[model samples]
Structure formats: structure tokens, C-alpha cells
Target: MIKKFTLFLLLVLPISAFAQRFSQYFSSTMVESFENPAQGIFKPDTTKMMAFNFFVPNLSASAYTTGNATTTLKQYLFLHNSTFPNIYVGRNNFNTLSTNNNIYVGMFKMFADLAGKQEIGFSWQIRAEGTAHFTDETVQLFDGGTNFNNLQPYTNLFNDRYYAQGYHQFSFTYRETLSPKFSVGYKISALSGIAYDNTTINQSDIIFNKNQSDGTSALYLNLIGQHRTSYTPGSFAANNVVPNFKNPGLSVSFGVEQHNEDGVHIQYNIKDLGFIHWGSDPHIYNFNHTDTIGLSSGNAGQNVYNGASFITQQGGENKSFTTVTNGLAEISATKYFWLDGEKQFKYNPILVASKQLFYNGIAGAFINNVQYGKVTVGVMGTYDDLKQFNLGGKIMFKSANAEVFLGTEQLLTSYDMFRAHRGNLNYINSNANFTGAGIFFGFALKFGADVESPANASSIPMGEDEGFLKRTFKNIFGKKPKDYINSPGATSP
Candidate 1:
């Protein structure tokens, strides 16, 4: 029964989820520039004035599910078996699922000017984020009391939280080089919400009592906390998934890049630091702890959820609330060296450290790339504070006029999943640690006139152009003298 419920949830989601690909850093792809904010993507004479994906998606997707339930996931999702899953319950066993999805439906950029190497872009993206946290007993309660001992009480087994959201983002970005060693950029976005759902059980307990009449059991469940959703349960229609201003929000991202005196390039970025206010009319459920339900012979587990909702019918109709986006802060250092004597082959390495803004977690990664002319290949490894480790690689074909890249950022997890589906997977101690799978791919094209400094180009006139952000800054704070490193014509001043 737990297998069927979980499978239904997974099937309702998009086939591909998203994860960050560290190898894309310094690759000069459009997604990289948009993600990092301050990274430059144009060559003075080689790149075109305009670049776009031409409606082709520049997408990155990956996901991970950790904890003991994954063994059962391996069975239903992989082995295609009919075995009833047995979860480790009443012993504080737990499981978690984390996933993200980013799809760039449209992206367009052009070299706006030369001062500070200024560039501007416009983009439209559809994104989704989610996480699920639950104990093994939580699953056991849903399908029946097969894993529970009658006359015994399980404490806090129903404590869990599940939240998922998707939205559309329209953004405008600007980035400029302050000097050869310094650059800064920013992105401002307006978000239109598509869907939102969250449920939490902060404190809960359950007891199974033997039923003498039908040989089944009676469930005495005490539940606390609340549930929130934008639509009625089992009534999420096609229109509910469409973008509407009924729920609107905003977000911003910024990044800074610098070249240190030691020949290393350092970059710092803060992404998606904002929140969304859901529609005014939303369903909210606050659970009360006094509900005793009778378990049927077959569908006992699913009835638990129905019983919880029934207990909250009085408070389920309420106003909406606000939620913060998953924000990130990260720093990385990069250095390159010529691999051969002739200098035709170049090798670059980058080390990165990232933090979750709203949570207590961090991840560190190493990326190594070798470039020969227009082709490049690289490998990467990352470990998080939670002890999760991932290994992946990338291959790219990039020239001044175009770029294309594809790779698995979670190769080990993908391989493990593949092997499990083939019915030949094993763990050293019945523990797979973490299980996941994903891939990232993107392509972009460049055309039109050559991108050049507006002050030096015959096709562009400085008198006809002034940056929107620059003008706005001066208008709000008054004009100021330019710094030595910020002047357009002062290369060595």
C-alpha cells in the first residue's frame, strides 16, 4: 500500500527534475551567465552581438531520495516486482526526498556596451522545487498496521513535512566588467505562481489496538500541525497549473567576480533571495489531536490521511500565506594552466563552496576541465555536510559563435538506479546511503553583427545609448566621478 501511494505521487510529477551542475561554471554558456549573474559571455571580436537559444531549452535537472524507504523504492520503481514492502518502523527510521527543476523556455542577450564590459539579457523560465520528510512509521500508518505491534504505542512516528511549488519567472539582467580583474551583475525577476502545496506534522503519535470482531485493528492517532494548499485535494485541474496573478511575488540575484593577485579567479553569488505570497483564497488545515479511526481490512493506510482531513474540516477554509524561495549563496576559485608545451591544450580547475540561505547546510565541489580548441571535457565531485557525495562529468563543444553541452551531474546515483532496475543491485550493508539520478544539457547560437565596445564601433553611437540601470542609479543618487578601474578608456590608468 505504501508502494502504491508513493508511486502515484512520483508519477504525477515531471519525469525530469533539476540539480546544480558545477562544471558549467566558466563554460560561458547562457545558463551559466544567468545562474552566476556577473560572469561574462562575449569575446571582443569573435562573439556575435546577439545570442539566444532560439526557443530551445537550456535545462538542468537532477534529484535525490535518501533514507531507508529507498530500498522499497528500488523494488517498485526498479525491480517491477509485486512484493509488499516492509519498512523499518517504531525505531525512529526516517526518509527524505529532495528535488528541483529549471527549464529556460526562452533566453535572449546582447552586448549592451563596452564600459565595464556591460551586457543585458531577458529570459523566461519555469521552475519547480520540493522536499519531503517523513519517518518510516508515517508510511506504515497509511497502508495499515502491518509494521506496527498491536497494544504498543509509537511515539512521533507521524511527524512529517511535505512541500512543493512551481512558478514562472520573467527577469531582466545586467552585468558589467569593472576592470580586467573585477565585474558585477544582477537579476531582478517577477514571478507568477502555478501551484503550491505543503503539509506538516510537528508532533504526533499512534497506537494500534486489536479488533476482536474483524481481526483488523483500531487506530488511535494524535496529530498536530497544519496543511496548506492552493487547490482542493484531488481537484488540481489544468487551470490550476496555469500562471495567474492571483499569486505573485518577486526575487533577485547578484554576483561578483574578481581576479586575485595570485592568478586565481574568485566569484561570489547569492541566488533567488525572495518570497511569494499565495492567492488570498487558499485551503488551510490545522489538525486537532483527538481522532480515533477504525482500520478497514484493506484500505486502512490511505484512510489515515482522510481521517486527518476530516478532523480539520472546521479550520481548512482560511486565508493564504507567504513562503520564501530556496535561496543559495556560494563562492568559488578557479585557475588554469596550459597542459602542453605548445599551449594549445589548456587545463582549468575550480573549487566551490555553497550554502543554503534558509537552512544549515553546505556543499563543496571540485571541477577539472581540459580544453583543446573548441572542444572541452571535465569531471566533478561534491560532498555535502550531510555526508552525501556525487560524481559526474561533462562534455562540451563551444566556439565563439555557438555552444552545446550535456552531462550527468549525478552519475553514480544514476548508475545505481540503472543497476537496481535491472534486478542486480547490492549494498555493502543493506544501506545504499543515498539514491538519485539526473542529467543536464544545453545549446545556444549566436548571430548578427560582431559584439564590440560601443565607443569604438562604427555601427554603434555612444550618444544614442545610456544604460537603463546606470541612468536610474544616477537619477536616484546623483552622478559621481568614475573610478580608475571603471573608466571605459583607462586600461592602465
Candidate 2:
């Protein structure tokens, strides 16, 4: 009965979910600048020459889950699968799943020059990235032993993988405006790799032969290119809590923006095109095997590499390797519309297309942004390569010297879950699975006088008329939003 419930959940549940990637788009705080260095120069905050931001510990995270079966928090934590009826296993059924977590704390050390003709910015940060993937056949083999049904031949079914890394980055950015309509910017980063691990099953073919009368079974298998790396065993007695930064890497980012006199703007950004080179100390192993196992043989012992048994045979090597970092590329277009005669309320529609190159996911979204005075609110509808549609929202408050914001990608899912939980209804619906959710929030402090002499510098007057975007910059840098009309040489839309 437990097995039947597992199978039911696997076959019936919606299979895709991810974190709030779109929240950063409408987030107007200084912390958002770290996501893309080009944003550091956006609109040029003239009042702030320096800024600092800290992600409250355990408050910043991004995670995603993909699988053949979906499980809810209630079912996973409380319910017993044995309460269900007879199990039905589908033929030609193969399930593959992956979950990734990136826990990061950005001490957004940022510096900028707003009054200069050529804008310059710099930042340093630390990040920890981790990922894991597994296939249903791999789990079945572990749970049921040699009990696989002999109805069909299994080929390329051992699809499992994992990767984890920690690193620090120092980024330097520069931007220059060639004309009122066009500007270009670029950022280069030096990456200091702290630790790394990766594992994957490249290929597999297996067949099970079961004797009908005696209930005996034999297995024929061919598996190849199972690769892994580890740093905590044998000669590498590394620390359990501290990071090791013996490896290093480099990356570069570039962006371009085009804005018109009519308040229509387009921007593009390509980030983190780089690779990391691991050291020789970490054990890199590769395995390949072809063998037959009888039921009485008790199966060959596993644990090939990383001290975990992944193949029928332990076949691999120990060495060094290099891997490319998963980077991001995105493009967006935004246009502002006046909502009132006083220009105190405005509406902006935005379109963004983005890709995660390594994870192999593409996403597109349409966002509506509404700004009234120092507050901004946004709603977005997004679709990703996972075939998942998501709704997201964001709210922000900004002043001349400080800003704070919070947002989420699964607003609808969260709301529905709350309502269902209150009414005592089954939270797991048939159409959609809410396996994961995340929220992002942070505060920043920007302080620097616009003039060389501190005595001559005064806070920006509140009565000036400035566009919403410019007001955002001013508020971020400690300047008040204004109602300026057609300021001279104004480049931002």
C-alpha cells in the first residue's frame, strides 16, 4: 500500500517548481545591484559615493526541485504511505529528479562615482552553491534490491548527478555614455574557489531475468562514465566547517542600454562567463563496468567515489579537473506611462527574457510596475523551460540614503496554501505542485556628499521635479523624489 501511494503521487502530481528568480527584477534596493554589476551604474546615484549592504544570515536563499513525483509538506512530514491501496508500477516508466540550493550572504561592499563623466563601481561578495540529481530507477534499485521487473530492457536509466561549490568574487565595473540614447558597460570578476564536488552517471543499460516458478532473478548491466570528486577522505583530511580556497577562476560580464526621449528603454546583460580549475588534492574518480549478478551472489559492493556506491562496479580515477560556471544572460525592455496629471503616480510595463545556461532553463515574463511617491509595487507573470507558469509580486520603499524591499515568486501558491490550511482541505491540488518557495529582503545604506567640500554640500531639496527612476536613485542615495519635468541631459527614462 505504501508503494502504491508512492506510485500514485509520482504519476499524478505536477512535477516542476523553482525559487523567486523574478523578484530581483523589480527589486529596487542597492542589494539588487550585485545580481548584475551593470545595475551599479544605472541612472548614476549622484548623492551616494559609497554604499554597504548585508544579507541577514539565513535570510537569503534560492532553491528548486524537479522530479517525476511531487510531494507536499503535509504528506512528506505527517502521512504514512502504507495507508493507500495496491501499488501499480508503470512499464517504460523512468523518473528523474534534481534539487538545487544556493545559500548566499552578500556583504555588498560597493563604491561608485556619480559626478564623473566615466562611471566606475566595485563590489566583493561570497557565495555557496549546491545541487543534486537522481533518477527513479536508481532509487528503486537501492530500495528493492534485485527485484526489478523483467518486462522491458532498461537503457540509459542511471541518470544521477551532484555538484557543490563555494567561492568569493571581486567585481570591477565601468560604464560610459556615448550619447543620450546609447550607453555601454562591462564588469570583470576574479573568483576565488573555496571548495568543489561533482558526480554524474553518463550511461547505463541493464536487463533483469526472473525465473517464474522459483522467483529467482539475474541481472545483466553495462554502465559507463560515472564520475565524482571528493576532498574529505584518505590523504585529504580537510576541516569539517571551514572553507578551502586553493582553487581560483575568472569571469567577465557585459551590458548595453538604449533609452529614448519618449521614455522607452531596452537593456541587455550577460554575466559570469568563466570556469574554475580545481586542485590536485581532491580525488576525481570515473567508473565503468559490465557484469552479470546472480541473486545468490549478494551483488557487488558499491561506493565507487565520494564514498558513495553509485555503480555495479567501483571503476574510477583520482585527479584534477576543470568545470565551467553556470552563467546567466538576460534582456529587458521597459516603458513608463503617466497615470495622473500631477505625475505623482506612474505605471510601467516591462518585458524580460532570461536564461540559466548551465541549468538549461529559459524564462520570460511580463511585469507591471506601479510607482506612487517613494513606494513601488509590481506584479509579474512568468514562464520557464520547466513548463511551469508562476505569478510573482514585489514591494519596495526607498529614501535618499536607504532602501528596503521584500518579494516572492509564489504569491498565489502561498496564498492558496494558507487558505487551504485554514479550511483543513488537502493543500496538494492536482493541477499544480508547490514543492518550494522563497522570499528575499534586505536593507542598504548609501552615504556620500556630491561635492568635494562637505560644508558646501546640502541634502537634495524636496520640491525639485525629477522622473520616477531618477527619484529612485536619489532616494537610494539620500535625495528626495521630485516632480521635475524634462531635466537637461536626462538620460534615464
Candidate 3:
């Protein structure tokens, strides 16, 4: 179980993708704009008519492990140590592991109308989200059955759960203004699932009885579990990661912005609410203990493993399934301040709370940024529902025509992880409650005719001809733009 779990966890880390780029969330970069749908990418007087990444991927990825498995996982995963990780059995204790990344393979956005407030965008990206939980007893059973000889029985110790999904996202995003202060945006996406793996053991119990006459141990295991995956064990293929319609899905994101007159910015979003259907014949297993072996052989542990295999075989099924995407809802506000009375020296503090739908994940972050002209540095403190606390920082260079940034959300813990990977054995004893790392970087450019505000435009006189979105869906949303959306609304788009 330990070996198998390790393999699965490793696979999920590299291939899986999902990200909440906090620093970039308000940066107004092409990636951030598409993510929010209601966020604008073009400013009439400053930015170009179009924005794109030219296939240069703007990406962020992160993974973390918690509970008693932290130390041993670091040693084995980073240092290639052969030592089995320590585990605390008998209690309903478990360890957790998660990995996420969001990669924009390519994106192109344009001003659909003369009014800078109306814009349309298209993008191709990859996204994923996942988490897993495993009990110490499960790890112990696979770690040479360290204490199985004892005359004790255990129940529910082997219960565990894992679920992860990854897919390609092709999106069409639209944003428009209501009355200059309030704007709305939405993104509709077609999704192609790349991978899906889910399994849960809701109940399990084990008892070992030894026959002193021949030292033959009788074993009994009662388990109930359901497992589902895109492919069978040893059948995972490279083509699975490539984009395809075999597993199709859809999602949509809606956003609203309130532009405050006092140099304050606020935005609300309902992002990625949708589902996917796995059309291919996925592998499924339903274990219920009826297939358990009669008795243990000379090697008691060997029989346990064999019994598990038998149940897996008896319960295996090939079928299709449906699953929901990891949707999100968030609201954020930022107050901007200019220091030194130069406007070039600026300070802004932001508060954001993000919650996940159909998943047990949420976070609240407080960010402080200081900027000097085109360069800005930010500090962030965040806490998540998983009880993890993090500190991170980022640096960005943004201008009217181009933007670039780099940062991490798990700075302190990532340092320990870095040390472990650097062959610093001392990291094994670090006092960090968890182990994780995150990194993100982005680059984008804008081109074409400079978007001109009404006062500076040479085009026809501006009138009450509303934007395309507002005209097309007038009844759907009848509101004025009292607020604007985009990262650094206090700065240029």
C-alpha cells in the first residue's frame, strides 16, 4: 500500500495542474483577466487593442504533505532514502497530500469594440485539483507489516480516500461595462478531461489469530471500498494527457466589479462551475470482503496481500462516470495609498477570501504591496481550512504594453523542502508542521492600435451605444459599472 500510494502521489504531482495565483489575481495580466471573465485587459488610453502570450505558458504549481508523513516523505522523496516513513497506528490518524497547477498554454484577447470597456478573449489552458488521505496502518501494512505479529485487532485503520482530476480548458471570455463604474464579465469553457482517479475505503477491519500448533496465522479482513480511474493499473498511457474529447466537460465563470472612487478596488467571482463525463471504459473496483482468502499461508503478510488482490480482482469493473469540476467563489478588496506624494511610490493592502465548491478547501489571504513606478514587491500571509499557515512574497514588473511576474505562496515551508532537495539531511528534523512548495511565473504583451478613451479618440463621437455584452444581454444584467475588475486596478491595465 505504501509503495502504491507513493507512486500514485508522485504521478499526481507532476502531471496534475491547478492554481490560485494570488499575486497575479489582481495584476490585470492576460491570464488573470481570462480567469475572472469580468476583469478587463484593455484600457482605452493606455493599453494596446490586443493581448497575448504567444504560446509562452504562464504557469503556477504547488504540492504539500501533512501529518506524521511529512518528515519521512521528504527524506524518501527528495533524498532517495530507502527508509520507510514513520506512522502512528491504532488511532484514526491519517496523512494528507495535494498538488495543484494551472497552465495557460496560449491566449489571445482583443477589444471587441471601440469602447475599451468591451473585450473578448479566447484561451487554451490546462487545470487540475486533488487531495488524498491515508491512514498510518495502511502504510505500515505495506512497510513489511512492522507490528502485525501482535495479538491485537484493528478496525477502520486501513480506511483511506483519494481523488484527483486533470483536464484541458478551452475558454471564450467576455467583459463589458455598464455605466463606466460597474462592469460584468463571464467565461464559458469546453473541457477535455486528461485524468481522473478516485477511490474510497469507507469501512475496514482486520484480525489475526495464530495457530500455535503449526504457527499458521488465520487472517480475516472486512473492507468496503469503491475505486475508479481513467485506466487500469499498468495501463496508463502518454496519450492520456493529450487533449481529447473522449472525456468532455463544460464550465462557466461570472464576475462583477465595483470601482470605488476612493482608490479602493473590489471584485466578486463565481468561477468554474461545471462537470465532466468520462466516456471511455474506466476501471472501477468495489470491494466488500466477500472475496477474502480462507486462511494465511506460512507468510502471514503474504496472505494479507494476496487476499487484497483477490478482492480487487473480484470487484473490478470497467465503466463510465461523471464528476464535477473544482469550482470557486471569492471576494476581494484593496485599498491603495501613495507615499512620498509622487504617485510613483504606492502602497496597497488587500484582503481576499476564496472558497471551493464540492471540495474541502478554502483560504483567506492578506496582502501588502509597495510599488515604485513599474516595479512592485508584495508580501502575503494566508491560512487555509486544512490548518496550514503560509507566508510568501512576489516581485512584478508591469507596464501598459507588457507584464511579467514571479512568486510563491508557500515560501517558508518551501525553504525546508528546498533544503531537503539540496541534500541537507538536517531538514528531516525541521519544526515545520507541514511540507510544501509553490512557484509561479508569467509574461504577457499587448499590441495593435492603442485603445483610446472617448476624449482622445479620433473615431466617431461617443454616445449611448452600449457595449456588445450589455446590448445583447440587457435583460440578463441591468446594472451600471460602478466598479472595475483586474489586478492592480490602482495601476494601469
lDDT of each prediction vs. the true structure? 0.75, 0.54, 0.76
The segments of candidate 2 whose C-alpha lies over 4 angstroms from its true place after superposition are: 1-19, 26-28, 40-46, 54-60, 72-74, 77-119, 128-133, 139-155, 205-223, 230-244, 289-313, 414-425, 428-434, 450-493
Q: Write the per-residue lDDT of candidate 3 for residues 1-493, one digit (tens) a residue.
A: 3333464585564422233456766667787898777778788788889999989999888888778767666655665443544566677678887788788999999987765378999999988877788776765564445456666767778888877888999999988876555778899999999888777888887776655476554656777888787777667788788888999999999998777777677889999999999877578888786433334433433556666656554478788889899888889888778898657898888888888887777888888989899999999988888887889888999999999898888888778778877888788655444878888888999999988777788786556667766565544544422222232454422
Q: Could you give candidate 1's per-residue lDDT for residues 1-493 as a string of tens digits? A: 5456565445343321236647788778899888889897887777998899999888877767777776666665655432334477667777776766788989998987765567899999888776677776766566566667647677777787777878888899899765556777999999888778877878887777776576766788777888888766767778766667788989999998888767888889998888888874578888665677778866675577677666544357767888887688989989889989998899999999888787556888899999999999988998887578888888999999899999888988887766765667573123564788787889899889887654556776555233454555556756522344455765621
Instruction: Quote the lDDT for 281 in model 1.
Output: 59
Report model 3's TM-score to 2 decimal places: 0.88
TM-score of each: 0.88, 0.71, 0.88
Positional deviation of residue 201's Cα in model 1 after best superposition, in angstroms: 0.7
Whole-model alpha-carbon lDDT for candidate 2 = 0.54
Steric overlap count per candidate: 9, 13, 19
Model 3 gets an lDDT of 0.76
Per-model C-alpha RMSD: 4.0, 8.7, 5.1
Clashing pairs in 1: 17-61, 17-62, 18-61, 18-62, 18-100, 19-62, 116-177, 142-301, 143-301
